[model samples]
Target: MNLRTLILLLIMVAIAALAVLNWPLLATPTTMSLGLTTVQAPLGLIMLALTALMAAMFLAYVLGLHGSVLLEARRHAKEMTAQRELADKAEASRFTELRSFLDVQHSAMLARMDALEARMSNRLKESDNSTAAYVGQLEDQLQRQGGSGSGGVQELRIEPGLRP
Candidate 1:
């Protein structure tokens, strides 16, 4: 098995051997002194029994502590997993909301661009119409001036009469 189990097993085996070796002493009855009395007992046996009892109690305590630690660790792991899931969900939701917001902003920008293009187109058309009208007026003015010259070479005059 593992190192801990191996060491524990070796310690138990050594203690058992020690107990077995003292079996003869354990069987022999002896007198023990009290405050005001004396009693005949197997001191070795009593000592061994007390040692065994103490060992059992210590082992139980250690096992109980280990079990509590293991359960606490499991509980913490579960809470961490739940917290991680919640965080992941929150992050994903934020991403989804951000994407939706970007999409709406993108559509609004496109619509604004379309409106700007339409306005630019109308301005260009208006500019072209005004230019054509000016050109027609210039042609009529040239015709009227040339009509008086009868196709002869004439000196052109400069004028500043163009106004809106």
Candidate 2:
């Protein structure tokens, strides 16, 4: 089904094929002649069966190893996925909290700006009234000194750093 399983299956098939192909070589008989003795025996089907059995056992062992590895990998992947989900949730929560804090700060800054603007407007109005009153007082003093006939100008000398 999975890649690992497929590979294991393929290996088993190859081993079986090799065993069948080598069957004739394993099943043949041989003779050994020493100087004073001669021995002969039939190996044939017995050797072939043993070789095939060993190959089958080996294939089984490899398949078991592959299955174990696949299981471990699947388990590790699940754990990592869960860890990533938790991290993402934590990051989202932190961002939401920061956004709320910034929103409150923005509102406070706007309110302070509005109050400052109002205070500046009142100060400017007071300054304008004071300037108008001072101008009127100067005109009245000029009229009392002479009705514009006596050159209603007075000059006063001042030292530096003295306020008039």
Candidate 3:
């Protein structure tokens, strides 16, 4: 047993022994004042009975206090559990929202990349067409210059003495 319980037990044993040893004295009648009048009664027994009654009341009070403390602790535990669940749900919702936002951004980025590719392809085709036109014009000029001269190679007289 704990020290406090052992000590209380010892004290109770001592009180019981004392009461047993003084039985004759406790049984003997004596004059006692009862507020309005005096009466002959066993004073020792009366005092012992009053002490036992008070001890019983104190025990009941202690039991009630302990029970109330246990109930309060249980209530607090339930409230903490509920709060934790709410926080978890809120965190999950935020993750879902973030995921949707990222998906939308990814889709938009893909669309922009496709648009850029189309524009680049159109520009490349335009560049190729312009390059081909320039080459065709140069061929036509060469053909006209050759047709104006004899069918053989043309001779240019930059100076009568020096031909290049």
Candidate 4:
């Protein structure tokens, strides 16, 4: 047991031993004065009884205080549990909102990539068409100049398989 409890138990044992050892003296009647009257009683026994009553009262008070504290702690625990649940729900909502925002952003990014790809493809096609037109014009000029070969104009032939 704790030191304080052990000490209290020893003190109670000593008081009981003292009362038992002096039983005759404790039982001897003596006159005691009250505020309004006087009475002949065993003063030692009366004092012992009063001491026991006070001890019992103090013990009752201690037990009551301990019980009340336990109840308060239980209430606090319940409140803490509720608060924790609320915080968790709020966190989950934030996560859900974040997920939805990310989804929208991801979709927009994909759409932008697709549009850029389509524009790049259109530009490539236009460049190929322009290159073909230039090649065709060069061939036509070379064919017309070939009719006057006396001027020593060399024939220019572009390879069909080559691309700029």
Candidate 5:
């Protein structure tokens, strides 16, 4: 049981014990003057009964309050649980959207990289062809000039660290 219930039960038990203990005293008669005449009655029993009735009423009130509080707490917990579920769903949707977006971007980047690589390869091939053509043209010119021999065509050469 909860602390509140346990405490209330203890209070009720104490009240019952007190009532039982004072049973003999409650049976005796006493007199009180109510401004006009004095009447004899079992004053202890009446007082005890009244006190017990008040205690019962107070306990009832406490129980009613506790019930109300427990109900409100349960309601609040339910609302929080629903809100948490909603937030989690929203987060999941956001992640899904983000994942899709990233996938699209990744594919686009890969395609662009592939195109760039192809272009670079083509350019390198063209450069190599051009260089080979230039070298072939130089060799053809040299052969033609060498074959025309007009005094064997003395070719002039320049060397590093030498100046004319």
Candidate 6:
């Protein structure tokens, strides 16, 4: 039992022991006084009974107070649990939002990289074609200038390594 209950039980035991020890005195008939009245009674037993009644009242009060405190504690615990759940949900939602934002950013960067690679490839092909056209025009001009010599028609062949 709790400390208060234990203490009350101890007190009750002490009172009972005292009553048993004084049973003859407690059983004797005597005149008792109230605030404005007098009555014939067994003084010791009546006093003992009144003390027991007061103890019972005190026990009832302690029980009521303990119950109210327990209820308040349970209510506080429930609020804490609800608050924790809300915080966890909010944290999870933030993580989900961050993940989606990162995904979008990553996709946009990949798209930009692809665009750059396509432009580079197109530029390399354009460079190769222009070089071939320029070489052809020079060869044709040289052939016309030298009319019929053995060295007049020197063909310029572009190797694959030299294409770009």
**Candidate 1 lDDT score at position 115:** 100
Q: How many steric clashes between backbone atoms does each model show? A: 0, 1, 0, 0, 0, 0
Q: Write the per-residue lDDT of candidate 4 for residues 1-164, one digit (tens) a residue.
A: 99999999999999999999999999999999998999999999999999999999999999999999999999999999999999999999999999999999999999999999999999899788868877786878777787766677676765565454
Please provide TM-scores, in order, for all candidate models, with all chains considered together: 0.69, 0.62, 0.61, 0.74, 0.68, 0.69
Candidate maximizing lDDT: 4
Expressed as tens digits, the lDDT of each residue in 19-92 for candidate 5 is 78988887888896779999898888878778879987997998999999999999999999999999999999
Off by over 4 Å in 4: 1-3, 130-164
Whole-model lDDT values for every prediction: 0.87, 0.77, 0.84, 0.91, 0.83, 0.85
Task: List candidate 6 stretches off by more than 4 Å.
Answer: 1-8, 126-164
Error of 4 at 130 (Å): 4.6
The residue-by-residue lDDT of candidate 2 on 1-164, one tens digit each, is: 89988997897698667667887665567775657997674455655567668878988998999999999999999999999999999999999999999999999999999999999999888778676666666666666666657774685333333222
User: Tens digit of lDDT per residue, candidate 3, span 85-153?
Assistant: 999999999999999999999999999999999999998887786766666665666687777875766
Look at candidate 3 and give me any clashing residue pairs. none
Worst 10 residues of 1 by lDDT: 155-164
Clashing pairs in 1: none
Q: What 10-residue stretch in candidate 4 is worst by lDDT? A: 155-164
Q: Tell me how candidate 5 scores on lDDT.
A: 0.83
Better of 4 and 6 by TM-score: 4
Better of 2 and 4 by lDDT: 4
Error (Å) of candidate 3 at residue 5 is 4.0
Model 1 misplacement above 4 A: 1-11, 33-37, 134-164
On lDDT, the stronger of 3 and 6 is 6
Question: Who is ahead in lDDT, 1 or 5?
Answer: 1
Writing each residue's lDDT as its tens digit, candidate 1 over 68-161 gives: 9999999999999999999999999999999999999999999999999999999898878777767877777788888777776555543435
Mark the 10 consecutive residues where model 5 has the least summed lDDT. Answer: 155-164
